[model samples]
Target: MKPSLLVLTSLPDDNRERIAASFDILYAPTHEARAKSIAKHGATIRAVLTNGTTGLSASEVDRLPALELVSALGAGYENIATDHARTRGIVLTNGAGANDDCVADHAFALLLAVVRDVPQRDRATRDGIWRDALPLRPSVSGKRLGVIGLGRIGEKVARRAAGFDIDVAYHNRKPRDGVTLRYFDNLRDLARWSDYLVVATPGGAGTHHLIDAHVLEALGPTGFLVNVSRGSVVDTDALAHALKSGAIAGAGLDVYESEPHPPQALLHLNNIVLTPHVAGTSPEANAACVDTFIENATRHFAGEDVLTPI
Candidate 1:
């Protein structure tokens, strides 16, 4: 008999069909459905497919006595009970590097959209307002960019910045080897030096609200901020206040603290642009992630090590 797999996140029909060919699927993409399915199929389930956002809890893992592997569809596993799962000998894997290009592309898209005031200009032009009626935006080329995390996505973002002649610097827990880019020991110092600040850090308790009022103030009145990382990294209240009070020139966000719902605090601000957390979402990226998950799961069931272990 094929191993049973519990799916906790929604997937495209084609992706679902692909997975169905490998294992017997127990589809549960909502809270209510998840509870019902887990209660009914816990004993038979040997594996699970989830995303970073809809993580598997320790309690849920405990109930699945047969579960041997857990796979996250994205690079993040912040919400997963990793330590507890490890204690039970459950293998954990993630889709790292699967969507790097897609996310890097979207990060630049957000940066340009906010810095050039693209959305606002599109609206003004539609209403017959000419260039003279609008305020002049700053040139993107030759500006200094500060990247918060120097991970795979950050490296891609820096490469793209090169085409615009933008100088790139970064801040991490420590300096990365072979990375000759300027490294800032402190986030405030990086913000002060950068004309554009892009956040690409992971989400977790450690990085929650890393970007607050003080960092925004250091970014200054002419600086712009872009967040392609998890929303928890930047405090929404602080960001709204910063934009409204001119602490920072403008902002662009792909993720926010309040997800699935628009950020209430930032809705009234004209200096900010928001996208519904789709930085790593494209048909090609999604296919890569799904393929990564299947490969990891297949290897795990075959008594082989996973490609990207968390």
Candidate 2:
């Protein structure tokens, strides 16, 4: 008999079919439906397929006593009560490199749109306005780029910056191997040196509010900021103030503090570009994520070690 699995969120049709070919895939329509499905069918479910943002809870795990594996596509696993699951001996894994290129692409897009004032320019063109009234926008090429938390995603962002010929410097716990990229001991120092700052740090408490008023001030009035990482990494109020007071030239963000609900103040600002936290989401990334899930799940159920734990 094939292993049974439950999909907590909707996936692309192609990915769904891929998963279905290996496991008896079942979809849950609602939270309540998920609980019901697990209670009714948990005995057969060996795996759960989910994403980091829409994570599985401890209660949900308890409902599926037979479950041995939990999978997330994307770097975050905020929704899962991991401690409880760990105690129960259930393994957890995530899609780390599955969407690196896609995320780097979106990050650069946001950067270009903000620095070049693309949205406003397009709107003016649509409203029968001309460039005579608009101020000159900054160029994206050949600027100093300071990237925070230089992990896999951060490295990807830097690699893209190479094409633009930007002076790239990054901050990580330890220096990366033999790379020519400049390393900064402090975030403030990095900000001070950068004309444009890109945040690619991890989310959670250790990095919470890492970009406070001081960092914004260090970035200065001529500097620009971009965050393709977590919203919690930035202090939203400080950022809004920075934008309002021209403490920084402008900003571009793909993620926000409130997540599904973007900040109310940002709605009125034209100095920034905003996206609904979808930097890492794409058809290609989704497929890779599901493929990772299948790899880990298959190994776990076959009484072998899983791939890429945590």
Candidate 3:
């Protein structure tokens, strides 16, 4: 018999059909009727597929008496009650390496956009304004690039940087034992040494607002900042102030302090580029992420250990 599962995010017909063959999926009731559905059928659920923002909670875990696994469709599992899951003996997993390449590509894209002032340039050209300000745009290649958090995605970002002939340095909790790349003892030090500072750290209380005023100042007026990591990693108000006051050269952000709400502070600035939190969005990344959940679910129900345990 297939184990029963629930999906908070709607998948395409192909992915949905694939999973349906292996699990008895519990369709999410209407938004207004969700509470009623959980109350009535929570206990029978054995698996749940959700994302970081819309995570499975302590109360929801308690309600699902038979739930053995909880999986996130991306790298983050922030809102999920990890402490509660640990106590309840429920296995938790996420798509760790799956979306890494896609996210790394976005990080570079954002970095290039800010350093070259692509957004402002495009707008000016479209509005029939050219060479009036014809402001200087910095060269991306042949500069020192500082990467914060050298994880799988960070490594990928570095691999691409090599093609541009940019020297890469990184700051991690502790320096990696082997493999080349200068290591900085602190993030502030890395910012000071870098022409471009790229943040790829994880999001959570530990890393919340890690890039504050001091780090921004360290980046200096000629430096560029790009964040493809979690929003909480950078202080929005401080970043805006830095850009406005010209304390930092410019910034490029794919994620912000507020997920859905636009970062109003950045919108008005001609020196910045913003995108909705879609850094890890790509067809390949999406499929691989969902496949991780399917594999985790299958392993859990088959009495095997999880692949990417959290």
Indicate which candidate wins on lDDT: 1
Model 2 lDDT tens row, 34-78: 888888898888788787666898878878888888887677777
Candidate 3 scores a C-alpha RMSD against the true structure in Å of 1.8
Over the stretch 1-310, how does candidate 1's per-residue lDDT look in tens digits?
7799999988999999999999999999999999999999999999999987889999999999999999999898888999999999999999999999999999999999999999999999999999998999999999999999999999999999999999999999999999999999999999999999999999999999999999999999999999998999999999999999999999999999999899999988889999999999999999999999999999999999999999
Q: Rank the candidates by TM-score, best first.
A: 1, 3, 2
Report lDDT (Cα) of residue 147, candidate 1.
Answer: 97
Pairing residues by index, what is the TM-score of model 1?
A: 0.99
Q: TM-score of predicted model 2?
A: 0.92
Regions more than 4 Å wrong, model 3? 27-36
Q: What is the lDDT of residue 144 in candidate 2?
A: 93
Q: What is the C-alpha RMSD of each candidate to the true structure, in Å?
A: 0.7, 1.9, 1.8
Candidate-wise lDDT, in order: 0.95, 0.86, 0.87
- Choose 1 or 3, whichever is better by lDDT: 1
**Candidate 3's residue-wise lDDT over 1-310, tens digit each?**
8888887765677777888989888766345445666788888888888777667779888899898888888888887898998898889999888899999999999988888888788888998996677878879999989999899889999999999999999999899888589999888999999988889988888899999999999989999998988889999999999999999999889989887799988888988889898899887888898788888878888789989988
List the lowest-lDDT window of 10 residues for candidate 1. Answer: 47-56
Model 3 residue 270 lDDT?
Answer: 88
Rank order by lDDT, top first? 1, 3, 2
